[model samples]
Target: MKYSLASGLQPPFTQRESFVRSHPDLYWRNKGIAAYEQNRATDAITAFRRAARYADKPSQAMIAQMLWVGDGVPMDRVMGYVWADLAAERGYPAFIATREKFWHELDRDEQRQAVVVGQAVFDEYGDEVAKKREDKALLLARRQITGSRTGHVGALIVSLRLPNGDFETVDGALYYADKYWKPEQYWEWQDSLFEKLPEGKVEVGPLQMPPKR
Candidate 1:
């Protein structure tokens, strides 16, 4: 049930629709993750902040992760510690590892405070993390779009132009042999897609299609 971009599954749960049905916090949490993965820090912060409002223990732990490194949000080491401790109290493996990983950063007092709050949150939301994982898996499965091209050659040419300090249009669409269709980040994405693309009659991943000769 692990959800990953490589799996080629579209998110099963509709963010907008499901958000209305489930707890607002959970919806925002998922949104935050999506934004973060897409490299949208500002959007991620907004979603993570909202998730904090009604967060169970697992959600709080994720919030702590966001705070600690500013991964997709602002930096707040102390807050991170607090959330991590809460996760550890519930015996969450990742939180426990993180706490130990950063043990030396905090003083005795901060550590003690984290332990106190963490235990309480853990008691309340330990099981929620499992549910969250399930939710993520469902989302991934739902997102699977048949014939949805993650890699397209023409769009990639535009993307390649932009990355190496070249000027290009904001529109992602590209023209190869005078046919235009779709938008893309650049050719590097395409190159990457070609190199790592699964082997097939036509493998597609990082470098599926080389530039026209």
Candidate 2:
């Protein structure tokens, strides 16, 4: 593991926003979103393009749509297709459908060019994209999100039900715990396994927002 964090309550979104701003990759993403929502298509495209350099998926998808329709940016169908295809590969399912829809919409040359361009983007940006995910996970771990709680395995304690972007486990995460921790710290029903502490449970569905301050 290249990352770890101390267990503690997460900072509020206001603070989180400040933290994210230091990361150009994530900061430009917010800028693009704000620009797009305000109907500043050109600025949105500009921000998205910069964000794309960090392999930001939403920015890639947004730029793809803008280019495909010539909304804020000039129509560069091939480049649009390239970004769309790249976003699709990164887990945005909608872009895959959009790219397919464009199959007959684009000429043979454009189609071929997009494929080549998309491949190039993939080869170049794959590592950066992966790094972004890792960074995000590390951030979440450091914050110890509000919904998160502690767990135990004998003497080994851990955080349970970590957010999806970080830990995908239903059980819990030992993400920031001591390296030598083990499940045998306490007497266990199963000698080979650890389990959630009886008091621990997580809301896996949409959150019920706290009454506004």
Winning model by lDDT: 2
TM-score of each: 0.40, 0.52
| Residues 1-213, model 1: lDDT tens digits | 121112222222222342223345446777766776677767866676556444333445556666777765678777677666654554333445556655668888877776666655454444444335434433333233112333233343322233346544332232221111111222122223223323344421211111111
Clashes of each: 28, 4
TM-score for predicted model 1 compared with the true structure:
0.40
Model 2 stretches astray by more than 4 angstroms:
1-16, 127-213
Q: Which ten residues in a row have the lowest lDDT in candidate 2?
A: 204-213
Best by TM-score: 2
Model 2 pairs whose backbones collide: 154-185, 154-186, 155-185, 155-186
What C-alpha root-mean-square deviation, in Å, does candidate 2 show against the real structure? 14.2
Score each candidate by Cα lDDT. Answer: 0.46, 0.52
Candidate 2 lDDT (Cα, whole model)? 0.52
User: Across residues 125-199, which tens digit of lDDT does each residue of candidate 2 receive?
Assistant: 554554454355434543443233442323323333333445232222433332212222211211112122234
Angstrom error at residue 126, model 1: 11
